[model samples]
Target: MLEDKNQEKTSLSELGEFGLIKHLTKHFSSYHKTTIKSVGDDAAVIDSSEKQTIVTTDLLIEGVHFDLSYMPLKHLGYKAVMVNLSDVYAMNAEAEQITVSIAISNRFPLEALEELYAGIQLACNTYNVDLIGGDTTSSTKGMLLSITAIGKANKEDVIYRSGAKPTDLVVVSGDLGGAYLGLQVLEREKQVFQVNPENQPDLDNYTYIIERQLKPEARKDIPELLKELDVKPTSMIDISDGLSSEIMHICTQSKTGCKLYEEKLPLDPQVISTCEEFEIDATMVALSGGEDYELLFTISIDDYDKIKGNPNLSVIGHITEENQGMNLVTRANQEIELKAQGWNSFKG
Candidate 1:
């Protein structure tokens, strides 16, 4: 599926780097007034004002971060943007722009790159972000994408991971475990297809989870919702890594312990059912399932009333004194020490 001989393929060398950049980014329009200049310049410029500027970048290597066998190029482009935007949103800021740099192998056709940029354009249009300056080059192997998201917030509004205090409530937006299970399903289908090339995967039942893996949306609305509710998070981090790993980052930086209740961790119906079918522990899946792109943050105990009934938010736990240590209080009435077991790319 990666290579389509029947489809019209134009060699990337035909356009060259500069031509390719112009051709792909021709349709991208600047949505942010802060963007003074976009592509086709010495460097893109932004007229940032009084708001604090937040910048975050992520590098995605082909085989290390993604597998193209089951992942679509369009989804890859969109997911790459989401990967960076999530970080900006974690700071409780509004994402306004992104710069995408890519290094591609010769195997990719210009049309394939077009498909890739089409996804990026869709994300920019949907998220109201502008495409700034980026570099293009050849690669030795597969694709590598590095996206830098730029955002802004008022001086008093930016949140950090080190500001969580004792008794602050730990909150997460959206559910967990779907992206990991989605990857599991896609990997399983890939294996089956490798064994039997004619096999057609029936993924009707796995649509939600599969999309969760392939086309995750950054939590751009959470910051807005918090502001509307008149609540501000004391400490915040995006759930790119996993619930356990992210909370550990918050606690370790904030110098406080946490106790996440297993029963309180949000899980969608499909996630719960898929976990049962896979014969895997759902709790561990939620704890270590990376790439969910949800926002996890801590807020003062006094603000609980503001967010209590919000469907988009879940109060999973609360901060504790550092002496108590980070733990997961299980539904079985057991307390287990939490570890950073989620999404270690260097793991053997």
Candidate 2:
């Protein structure tokens, strides 16, 4: 019946606000014990027990954060959830629930919303989280999504950006720069399509990078892996605003200095090749290209033995005394001050 409704074209006024909310969120089921009550109430209820609750929110505007021309509604929904979940993971916590509110224009049909919600449901199912509650209202412009993700962790286990001390080893999970290059590819293809509508882009060579941009997955396993290894990170943050900016955040908050090794920065082959093809520096891309969603953390140097040679982890640098300042050691051993060049929504 729901699938049939998704196939039919219906107006927002036909269902009204409450009717649309019920229709969209009817399929969500709770999996977390912390979710005491989900939806259908004046307010969603949660039982944090003795754990410390961590809440993070992010806003995604249609034209600013994403370009709808190339971004599918389903992917957009999935990415929105992933972006918020990544913040929770960065704090070394388990995300239990999320509230997804959207203001969409009437230009979007019911079927379009169903497609977006389908992606949201897929993300919730994959992450074992509950869609507790949200709001749906009319928009005069395009669309906007505001997601608030709630998570929990014991007080001792909750990591923060201010926890790092000098001599800690810096580490990152997976790779970097792929997402930014992916956007470049998509934009290039979009422009080409505009000039020649009949042309078909051969995207086989750009598969990995494109997926990185369109369907990035949060690093949900890094915290679990650290627990298994019995290694606690001194400071941690997700790579949303590029490596340089994230590194600066940790340094500034922790009141420490850092020396990032350019040679140690990890890069996928696709990212490297794409950088060469685009005539851009791969190091610069890794430093300032955001949205990798990988975890950037600092660990006690003594724990190095446990993570050494781990395929999923990379030891890229080390923390230093405050006076040392933030510097990047180039492959040729040139020391250059690291700059914060990550994404700035205000500038746009």
The C-alpha RMSD of each candidate to the native structure, in angstroms, is 11.2, 11.4
Q: Model 1, residue 225: displacement in angstroms?
A: 0.6
Cα lDDT of all candidates, in order?
0.88, 0.90
Q: Name the weakest run of 10 consecutive residues (lDDT summed) in model 1.
A: 36-45
- Count of steric clashes across candidates, in order: 0, 0
TM-score of 1: 0.86
Off by over 4 Å in 1: 1-49
Q: Give a tens-digit lDDT track for model 2, residues 17-39.
A: 33576799999999998765454
* CA deviation > 4 Å runs, candidate 2: 1-49
lDDT of 2 at 232: 97
**Residues forming the 10-long window of minimal summed lDDT in candidate 2:** 36-45
**Residue 214 accuracy (lDDT) in model 1:** 98
Write down the TM-score of every candidate.
0.86, 0.86
Q: Tell how far residue 212 is off in model 2, in angstroms.
A: 0.5
